[model samples]
Target: MNEKLTKEEIMAALNERHSPEKQALLSEGRVAIAGLGGLGSNVAYALARIGVGHLHLIDFDVVDITNLNRQQYFMEHLGMYKTDALKSLLLKINPYLDIQTDCVKVTEENIVDLLGDEPIICEAFDRPEAKAMLVNGVLEHFPEKKLVSATGMAGYGSSNTIRTKRLMKNFYLCGDGVTEPEYGNGLMAPRVAICAAHEANMITRLILGEEEI
Candidate 1:
């Protein structure tokens, strides 16, 4: 039979991968991710693996067959609420993480309330309008918090174009910043994950007090 590792052992393994300073910062940082599809799901996965201390995930949708193409969810998770499913998966990765999830739709009126005092905001909505709403609302209401967003991650290849950009003070955007899902071109796993990685990496950098590019 396989032996189960204790929480201390699990944390020891994580600390080996990250420096004490980096791990300390990550373990103290709190990030809120809006939406739980391709971008949000993947970003959350990456952050959890790195031992981010707290995550506030908000998503009003449920897993569907279509999400299997690019999202982090599995076939078994189909039909479950995205927030609940993601929370389950993230906890499996790091049980010590402090995760708070909201299964309600994020709106202009409730964005700040849902996100609370988290200093990092991740924008992971798939629709253009929804993305704009979260970005605008957060920037307007919580200008001090850093906002990392994704755009134009559809299609495959051309991975180089997916980059992290400091759009303005306290605002960072990832992806090609142009491509959109259209005829013949659709969202795929590779590009979406790349964008998600960019967002996750930027979040890590900000948390570590590294200079933003």
Candidate 2:
């Protein structure tokens, strides 16, 4: 039999694992994800499990069998919009999570409206052009917002090379930043998740008032 967990009960359990002060910071954290593929999916999962109070999920893609190799979705989610599928999965983990999803492609015109209020933004687009678009859009429009982006996680490369780099005062990049799927063994679960973890950890640190990147 499955039992429904009350919000208080969930918080109580989280409190036992995380210090009250840490949980409070996480609960007050609000972030936006610009792609619901590999990096976004993993980052969302991490944030939800750690008690992020609010999340804005943005993606115009859908779950596909090809995504299973590195994404958070399962076979059951194939063909569902990424935002919808990820939101459903996340709610199962933290029922009280404030998840606002948009099933539309992120463009410069809509970027501000979609992520205006989120202090932290994660860029998880697949293509270099798409990643540039989001990063440029955010940097140009929301200069003060913290942005975490990834590159070069593709392939069965050395995990040690996957690192978090503080590019700007508020921008961080994770991964080897050199490996490309077109030239390597291609995207694998372990490396992708490793980079995603770096992004998630950076976001959490930012939420907890860590200034040293």
Candidate 3:
């Protein structure tokens, strides 16, 4: 016979790993992720593993075979919408999670509506234009909210180069900031996940009341 852990049992294990106080704070954390590519997918995985109670996953793209190199999706998730696939994966990690999924592209017009409810927004688009759209849109429309973004995480550069920097009172940037895929080898898992960890850690720090990075 197969057995499944109850939600309470799962939560108890999470709290034991995260500590009761830290898990309590994490459980109250809310974030909206824009673009479920490498960075966003890894960030969502890290946060969900740490017991972030609520997450709003926004992505218009479907999982592609190319995404297997760096994204969290598996072979079984190919062709599935990123939001749906990621939500399903996250639920497997933390079944008690509260998740919201949006399958529409995050255009300037809809960005505010998609992310307004969440206190922190993560920009994880692959293209520069799309990244700018989310960052600019969130900063312009929701100045009071926090935005975490990434740049130059592509290629097999030194993992140490991946870092988090405070860009403004409400914005943070992660990654080497110099190794664009066009110039470097291309997006690899280690560097991408390293950058994503910076973003995820920064978001967690913010959630835990440590804003400075």
TM per model? 0.96, 0.98, 0.96
| Each prediction's whole-model lDDT (CA) | 0.90, 0.93, 0.91
Q: CA shift at 181, candidate 2, in angstroms? A: 0.6
Looking at candidate 3, the ten consecutive residues that score lowest on lDDT are 1-10
Score residue 38 of candidate 3 by CA lDDT: 94
Model 2 vs. true fold: TM: 0.98
Among the numbered candidates, top TM-score falls to 2
Which regions of candidate 1 fall more than 4 Å away from where they truly are? 1-3
lDDT per residue as tens, model 1, 25-142 = 8899899989999999999999999999999999999999999999989999999999999999998888889999889999888877887679999999999999999899988899
Look at candidate 3 and tell me the lDDT of residue 154: 83
Off by over 4 Å in 3: none
Show the lowest summed lDDT stretch of 10 residues, model 2: 179-188
Query: How would you encode candidate 3's per-residue C-alpha lDDT over 1-213 as one tens digit per residue?
Result: 246678888778988888889888999999998889999999999999998999999989999999999999999999999999999999888778999999999998888789889999989889999998888888899999989999988888788888889989999999888888864499999889999999999999999999987
Model 3 collision count: 0
